[model samples]
Target: MRAIKDEHRAARHRRRRLSLAVGIPVAMAAAAGLTYGTAFGVFGEDAQPRASAATAAGAAAGAASAADDVADGMADDVADGFASVNALGQNGTYGGRDGKTVTVKTLADLEKYATAADPYVIVVAATITMDPKGKEIKVASDKTIVGSGTSGQIVGGGFFLGQGVHNVILRNLTIRDSYAGTWNDKEHDFDAVQMDGAHHVWIDHNDLRHMADGLIDSRKDTTYLTVSWNKLSDNNKTFGIGWTENTTADITIHHNWLRETEQRNPSTDNVAHAHLYNNYLQDVAGTDITSSYGNYSRGNTKMVLENSYFEGLNNPVTKDSSAAVVQRGNVFVGTSGRNESGGTAFDPKSFYAYTLDKAADVPAKVKAGTGPRAATGVTAEAASSTLTVAKDGSGRYRTVQAAVDAVPANNSSRVVVSIAPGTYRETVKIPANKPHVTLQGTGGSRKDTVIVYDNAAGTPKPDGSGTYGTSGSATVAAEADDFQARNLTLSNDFDEKANQNLAGHQAVALRTAADKAFLDGVIVEGDQDTLLLDTAAKDKLGRAYIRDSYVVGNTDFIFGRATAVVDRSVITLKKRWDGTSQGYVTAPSTPADRKGFLITNTTVTGDVSARSFYLGRNWHAGGDATLDPQTTVRDSALSGAIRTTPWSDMGGFPWKDDRFAEYKNTGAGSGTASGDRPQLTDAQARNQEIADWLGNWNPTALNPA
Candidate 1:
């Protein structure tokens, strides 16, 4: 068998001799309900415990000392000198989506989308000049800039993106200090957009790249805005992201992507109010977002990332702040570290690294103290939250993964663990054999807490093997049964800015092989394999119930042939930076006869226009993958951001009428219930294999009920 952990082996040797040094403590802990799976030896069984410690920061950990006390090798510092409560969530304090009713063509036209009276819609083109006097962007209390992606490109820094005007909107355009084909000797000190003292702004659907300074510089004043659906990349030889020192309140950077840049200072100086959500970030070659200077904080940043990808990056001080990168469901392939330590790497295109259970190359685990290698090790009870794990003096351990690893197999009692409010960066696994394991979060609200990671399928292994499926390509892999998660997010932040379009893209955020798994108020994110609910099991009725959640992805996101009922959730289509068709919805590779998927009461929204995305298509498994006719979408909102036809077609086969179906849904992406459509009536929607699939499980109440 694979070599046992050295220390555990030695402990067994001692236990055979009836030693009490290790055995006594272990037995006591186990009796106290701390069962270390596959019990270790009495002495010298485990290799030395890996390096872990406790400092004065917000987190503290405890463990029985064997080698000079747990304090010697353990360092209390969180990930890469991580500080606490630094940045926050998106939509900064605005309660809802900006419902502006106007067609904008320039920066001056942006006041229309605002909650104020004289709202303008700012339209930009191939190259619009910013008034050097800063008068062009001007002074507005409530203004909106909507670039008609087709008509305009705003150029030069005299007025860039922000300049101390409150309640403004910058949408749908490429805003950068254009080189004017040649370097403009006239471009001076003005930022592309400067938040001099701006408050309540929204920067959406704009491409801000290749600048001398920054895509955004918000340091002065209480700036509150939602920066969504914009592409912030390739700021090489320049600054990519900069949040200078100041009291910026409630800044939400959601749906906007950042990649292939340099000098990314996320938490530069002291800042607050940061909401980061689903956006593709690749090859980010700078400092992690969110600097650690001050703690002008509130509860915590609503840092959410769904259906985005983090491919590759060469810089390695951090893939990102282990404390700040609340990554979910993003791919991280061929990811490498700039440091002299450990980090994985992957090739961008060959996500298909393995086939039929054969072994593939694997990348090394990230070295400690670099990138996410740094972490916050806290026992379950360290913080206060909604869910709480019950532990005792015997069951003492530092991190969440450690506690789960300690659970005994075939235990008679169910074990439920609680996580407090904090962004924990650890790769956790619920073993296939460990049943009755439930991971719940403890936040005042479902959207306030999280557990995140950014491990791409193609990262490198320490032994030089391709780290895709070799290392389990998932940040959070659930192989156990009866597993349930609530009010928290599980993500694989293989953000491309950090991974550089290199994270072999097929990163699985939630890899499920469990039976009767329940996920509620949970968010799953990534670019390609965001929510991989895999029932590649021998059982036929492997079921998953996901509700009140949001799943965002660019590619075959909700893939895997698992039988699942997605209810009251969002299966969002991710948009591309170049304004291309981002991607489609479900690609269920269900074998015929198995109930595949049923999506109800959800919304399909994307950053691009309605013509850029499709509904359901052939899930790449050749003809075996029919569009299965099993999958269905009903009673939901389809945004104007989805393309209607060409639902599913592979290399040779056409899956138009095979599996995909829709019903009684209305919204921007909704169409007449006709041709090549299986739009269900309210009656049929309540009673089919779709409704009867998850018996007693109301997915329209969690359905496949």
Candidate 2:
């Protein structure tokens, strides 16, 4: 039996090789079982055929058995790869380290432990503060540097992975304010964390931010490096995949949250191959994932970009004439540019046997699965008890508003409020003093847990703040930081059918001015400015992440100045009762230097007629028409109800100069033949991702699940 299995495996390997050489897709080859070992398995040892017909039937049966074995083997290989998502190429990604543990609390101890050649597990006991002018600390081989909870940190200085460094794992620590000796001089300085000629490295779950120069730079023959579950931000030059000319690097970067970083979110210059998957890039200002090495006329850089989310990014991915980029199942929302200039090609299937996620599923999956347990705040919440609320007066509070009011002011940690299914008609507000609050629905879905109110933009407030402006008319308003809601619905039923032109005609369902606000499986429904996402403070920026939710409205339904990402959600356009024409989808009043909105992996469908709805219109709220109104709709499907002139003018401001773009969208409404829709070049789209907008804030890390 052993010999039979070995023989069949060898035969299948040969068949697979042949099939690959002929350029067949691996999926197809797997389906056919590589046409190997089919005949040998069916015939039993004692069985003998009496006639030619019987012998032929026996042979056919054996072929089928062998094919089944081959298919099973392929399935096994796929399963193995899935289980080893963070492993480094058949080797343990966690570097060589003995079970012996060592505690390092100060800069002196850190240097001593990190450079020692002995294998040891180093636990950082406290934050190590260093001066910016200090020398860099170099880490040696065969060691693990982990933090004790969120207390461990390395501040003001940085670390280095120099030559001969191998088998290292660094995780669960925060590194900040690592300024280069001098600014803006790449030749004279190094990144906050530099990897030069290192091998078998794993860097995960570290919070790195506010560096003067590049955040993380890997160059000079670095191989088998994995950077995952890290929060990187506030650096002008972010991550570099390769810096040395003509040097090849083997690297895989996944599930990293890069926020507010200007450029080089891992720019791959002359690298051999990079596997970048499941990353969230938000509010990134400059070009993202650039592959241009034309200055040196270098070799091709093959990149596999998959299962990533880009929000408020200027450029998403670059596919120049020389580089090879394989993009599959990526979500780009509210981002302006996507690979309009497509030249190079590569296949991700050739290197591995894995399944590609649907673009719509990427946002939710990445949010739930990406990053460390600490960053997501998932582990502690699950292990602790939670508070509950019911609208029917069964337990705790009788209304959602009352429950929200019960939360203590200025809370730092997450306080989850689980609300039972009911429609509470009262207005609700999360005050600015209260932060880190999660309002979760205990029902089956967002529809079952409802919060409704009837108030238009012109409605009078009890406090006499005059009529509620478009920003003030929300039924449910969140005005704090780290606000989160799941499986709930917020609606404003102001009878838009009766008040079209009257009262300014803006009824907001949900208003969020919270920084790091997150919503999962929620709903916001209304007409004319249904969702208001903005910042309360003028000095700071607000960010919101909405995933796997549903939104319905008309006339700038989802409008705001905040850096917002809507992923895997549906935006439905409601038909006007008067039946003249539908209004626009978005009206963004973003700040000049900040990116605006992203709608990715979503679908637009509604009650309107064919060619009735517009996508967006520019809102010159800040009195700057020269500023680019950053709004992107990409990797989404649109219904025929959407018009060919997808963008419109607002208050005499034509949207031609606004940064509005569609990238490889499919559906009845996304036709480019009329030349009205603006498209982004491939090079420009390369830099767009969720990491660009929400710098150093891991939107996925906030998920409770």
Candidate 3:
């Protein structure tokens, strides 16, 4: 044993003996319903009186303090180090505080809310056994999963925080018993908590032990994390951080108890800043569990170890030659093998503020402080409701329409129906009663979440009543006021070539027939009549604002009578399903006294032949001569596919009879002001701006232009 010589060793042991003597009586009294203050008085004249049982019962269950004073400290503490840095416009890891709170006792309810689109504070109320052993529940961003006192337990399972997920907290739970009776678990990759490429996470005050592989596995460059006040024991590979070759992970591990662990307490590999302080590591010499190493710094990791107590068998502090380790103020008793510390590491104080406990008091403090505490009033209250839709049955609903249907009718506040990243082959509709419903996609990109159908205008209905008309053949129809869709794709996959035997090929992808509708960062794709922007009635005022989105189609794709504005968007003109390149971009049929369609600051391009596509055509609905159709394409980049004479007549309605014009448009397709291609004057173009088309409804306020 290469134990460090210290003159104060006897004094430290005496203090530990006194603490244990005093703590035993207090614990026995508390468990027996006796007076806690009376027993805690054994701490002599300097000790403060313990709190009453009623008051202590309301403290947070994860407080990393002694049982006598667990009520008033570290229960609601924010994370330190890189996790405290402000990123993505969010300051620190405040999980689910902005959303509603819910309690779940079953695995189904836990998985439903944990993988939801909206933020939630989920309280696990009971010991939920995993149906399939070692099933890892995938947790989404902006979530808080905490235990209700010490009753919450997850057996034979764990949680997975995937890539790009952020702002999550896991506290006050016991996740264990995933060990499949194998010391070297090669079959199962079961871990108590695992994260890959996730950031701004806090894992605190939990009891993690007997896992198949690692108690906590932070892999693939997971950063900005703090694992504090946890008790990790009874297994090989207690904790393993960093699997990536890149040294980008930043983590803080403090105030934890590593008892009877074989190795990796914890092994820090390829980490940017690994700060370990105020922890206790103990290993028995004759037990089956023997520590291979205590705190390991491997790869290009930079670690700072301070104020810790190590009572171990072998290799307490070790580092690779390529790694840096700065150790200070640590007491090593009865240790052997390499106790090496060299190279310069970063100062943690530069990133965040933290207090350190003395090394002599670490073993005593960590034993009493680590792991879950008693009950505390840290549970949040419910706010707005959020429903989740996932194709994998992990969320509350498997389909978007089911989540939408679950929303209460005439709801006063907003209800977000969050769609997980997957292809949903169905139609979804938001009725007029659901006004503040927002369909949000939880994905990295808009292309990840897809809602699609294959309905055509001439396709016969299943009821045999009649064929679905142009308006009825929509994949997603929003008939509610104040409706919004973001970060998703809506497509009508109607094959015109395959359906040649059918009559009409007008397949619509999306339709909005209400006021104050907004679409942002979305993809709408189809062939003909792809997007129908219409009103509930011919005389009603229906306005739609689409920004930073994509509209793809071939023939007369965007046609309606509503006052609509497509701003800062992309219009992709595609070939017909029969491999031809002849189609019209828009067929506007505006009312006589309404603003028709404004395509401003947009890019119109596609993979079609030059001069094969027309900018628009006049469409008088049902050949109604009283309707004055209008379309204005201005401040946009037109492609070579656009015809020089962009306007054309439809259904015996002359193009000149309607309002079809362009202003300040660039690109090869744009032409000079001729009688065939009307051009708006500088003064007239101002009246046809996006702001004028949207009226007092400021869609830009919700989603910036």
| TM-score (all chains, Cα) for each model | 0.43, 0.45, 0.49
Alpha carbon lDDT at 466, candidate 3: 94
For model 2, what is the C-alpha lDDT against the true structure? Answer: 0.64
Give the Cα-based TM-score of candidate 3 against the true structure.
0.49
* Model 3, C-alpha of 427: deviation from truth (Å): 0.5
Residue-level error in angstroms, candidate 3, position 384: 2.6
lDDT of 2 by residue, 1-705 (tens): 010000111112212211012121224322322121111111111111112232233234433543453232210001112212333433434332332456788888888888887755577768898744435689888766777667777887677889868767776678787665444556535456788887777777678887766678877877667777678876767787666766466666776777776677777776666777777777733544332210111246767777777777666666546776767677777676544323353453454454545656655654554333342221222212233455533333456765565455676666666677898887889899978777776664456678899888787777887888777778989998888877777889898676656567788999999688887667788878988888886446999877766777878888878998776666767766576657888988777667788886666766566787888888877666654566777766676777787887776776776667776566777767234787655544444445556656765554322
Total backbone collisions for each predicted model: 133, 52, 3
lDDT of each: 0.47, 0.64, 0.78
Model 2 spans with C-alpha error above 4 angstroms: 1-385, 463-465, 498-502, 579-581, 673-675, 702-705
Residue 516 in model 1: lDDT = 70
Best by TM-score: 3
The Cα error of candidate 2 at residue 495, in Å, is: 1.2
Task: Pick out the ten consecutive residues of candidate 1 with the lowest summed lDDT.
Answer: 76-85
Better of 2 and 3 by lDDT: 3
lDDT of 3 by residue, 1-705 (tens): 101111121222212211112122323322322111121121222212222221122122212222223233344434555777776554677566445667899999999999999987788989998879999999999888888788889999899999999989898899999999999888999999999999999888899999998999999999999998899999999999988899988899989999999888899999999999999999977889888999999999999999999996589999999999999999999999989899989999988888888999998888887787664313311112455666654454567886676565677766667678999999889999888777777665667789999999999999999999888999999998888887778999998899899998999999999888888767888989999999989989999987767788888888999998887666778888878989998998899888888887666777777789998998999989999888888766676778888888899978887788888777677789878877777656545666567756766443222
